[model samples]
Target: MAASSEEFSVNANEAIRISLVQPGPNNRLITKHEFHPKFTYPIVGEAEQIFGYKGLEVELLFAAHDLRPHLQCSYVKKFDTVGTTSALDLNKTFGNFLPPTAFQQGFESEVLDDSKAAEWTPPGVCVKKYTRGGENFEVWAGSLLDMPMRTLVDNIQIFIVFFIEGGQFINLEEVDWTLDRWRVYLTYQKASKTPTPNASPYLFVGYATTYRFYKFQKPPKDHIPISFPPTETITPNTLPSRVRISQFLITPPYQSSGHGSALYQAIYDQVMADPTVLELTVEDPSEEFDKLRDMNDFDNLEPQFKAINLKIDTSPFASMDRGRLKRVPTARLLPLDQLQAIRSKNKIAGRQFARMVEMYLLAQIP
Candidate 1:
């Protein structure tokens, strides 16, 4: 039966309080324990309760260590406020060392009692006591001094569990806590709960990079090739110029939601706000040109490129329709819109040609 506080207190004093227990060969294994200073036990009552016998024959077992005879010890129970589990009073048998600074750091000692050695519990209270052994008569107040020397030797066990395996002592500061430094992680939060926070209007966060657009004084009149080298035939005229996104990830959690289009519009708006830029480059219908090819309208690719502002200053040749070869001069220039109308008369051919052109312009080249 669990003893009452008063009864346990009376019985606690009869037994010598030990904080540490050492067991096995070489005394390598040790258990750390705490005791309440005020708690003590009545010898006869404790023994009878332990054996579960009334007025029966009982004998105490003894052993020897370091030329000193080992005396019978009691299995004292300790308590903690946080939980109902009781710890053992093995402080004496183990003699484990607890650093004063560690105790002062208010680790386990954060729950110590002010009095009663046998009544000690986890978060055990600190107490001052005189050294028991001769020639080392000194007073100390920390739990480190209340245990046995062999117990201190077995601290390797405590080290393995509490630190190495249990991870009770972890360095949380070392963790990379921020998912995105300037950005934030976006969860598909329920619309009913709370509105999500918006990203900075000036900055954009992309899947892999961050950016902000820089305004230009004079935007080109037609499609501006954001890609390097304005002209394909490079003679150094298209000096390496830099173009940047207004702000990457300006709208996080964009998903397929119209937010992407809105963000794009915002970028356009920002550029438009600066009256100097009359035109800005954006993907156009030529993107669909890939699905058209292999028909009379196969030649529509070149014209589509021009219709979308990707003006082609190249030549076009006419194929022979009669046995008498007709020569059509090359280097012909035609507005893309005009050519598209001409090709549309042949529906199937027009579509096939459009697809071929779209693929060439939209698709990255090798």
Candidate 2:
């Protein structure tokens, strides 16, 4: 008796698993995960099916600290080709989605090397270090012009596309000046247990990236043009710009805690601290991300909102006809000048500020 064609096909998402593994004495247990990719169409096909394989399992392991990648595939059995029908070449299939180094024969051993992986730390300056739920973590940031940072992102960029919906790759090949305008924020935590010899005791948490785009400022009507000497230094980092968080993710294991909020607040604090930064923004934020931003914004503005007392005046509503009022007098209900002042001082965009105002006003209801 022979089985049907459906018997030979497997779901690519369920079959593929990605794990962030730590350096051990040896690749003893082959860290296991049955995690699914958010999307598998890019790798296999629209159907997201792998044909000619039965009980397929693929593990894509990355170094816990540095994110060096290694991919391994196995299955109960691969069906033999029947003329035009052939079993998929799993490794070759995945190669399209991973960096070429991931397929290098000796890459797994190198990635598991604790001596180097332990020493590897998050790039850039440590912007914040705090603990939540008794777990310690730190967030560091670096410019994209950095070689090590660029290499780090290159290794993990594929995961961004895989985990984040509608995510795309960052063009590291951009010119130096342009690259300098980009920034990456990485979070890490020290190992809670013992460490290997001469190895780092830190593990990777997750990361976020930001791009600083130039912000134009209108000059005063009475201002005169002034020319600066060619010798004077001017760099993108020093220009008045709006920083937009391009991609953000807190790996599965570390999520559901306050880490995402902390990372976001860290970025906000860092960007706001920069005299050159005009404002902070996010590019195509997901719904989950929007909620996170809203939480942080609400908390951050609470004190400021309190000092000025952001209470909505109800005088306009008091005299409204019960059933005939066609419009709400927004101007009379809220102080536009006060809100605008707060928005400018806080460097929040108009739309976001308006949303926050709505949330604040609603909170005042008895």
Best by lDDT: 2
Q: Each model's C-alpha lDDT?
A: 0.26, 0.78
lDDT of 2 by residue, 151-177 (tens): 789888877767787887786655455
Q: Provide TM-scores for the models.
A: 0.20, 0.86
Residue lDDT tens for model 1, 10-61 = 2322243323222222323222232222211222233322221122211111
Score candidate 2 by TM-score against the native: 0.86
Count of residue pairs whose backbone atoms collide, per candidate? 61, 1
- True-vs-predicted CA distance for residue 238, candidate 1, Å: 23
Instruction: Kindly report the root-mean-square deviation of model 2 from the true structure over all alpha carbons.
Output: 4.4
Model 1 worst lDDT run, 10 consecutive residues: 59-68
TM-score of 1: 0.20
**Model 1 RMSD vs true structure:** 29.9
Return the number of clashes found in candidate 2: 1
- Please report how far candidate 1 places residue 338 from its true position, in Å: 9.2
Error of 2 at 292 (Å): 0.7
Ten consecutive residues with minimal summed lDDT in candidate 2?
Answer: 26-35
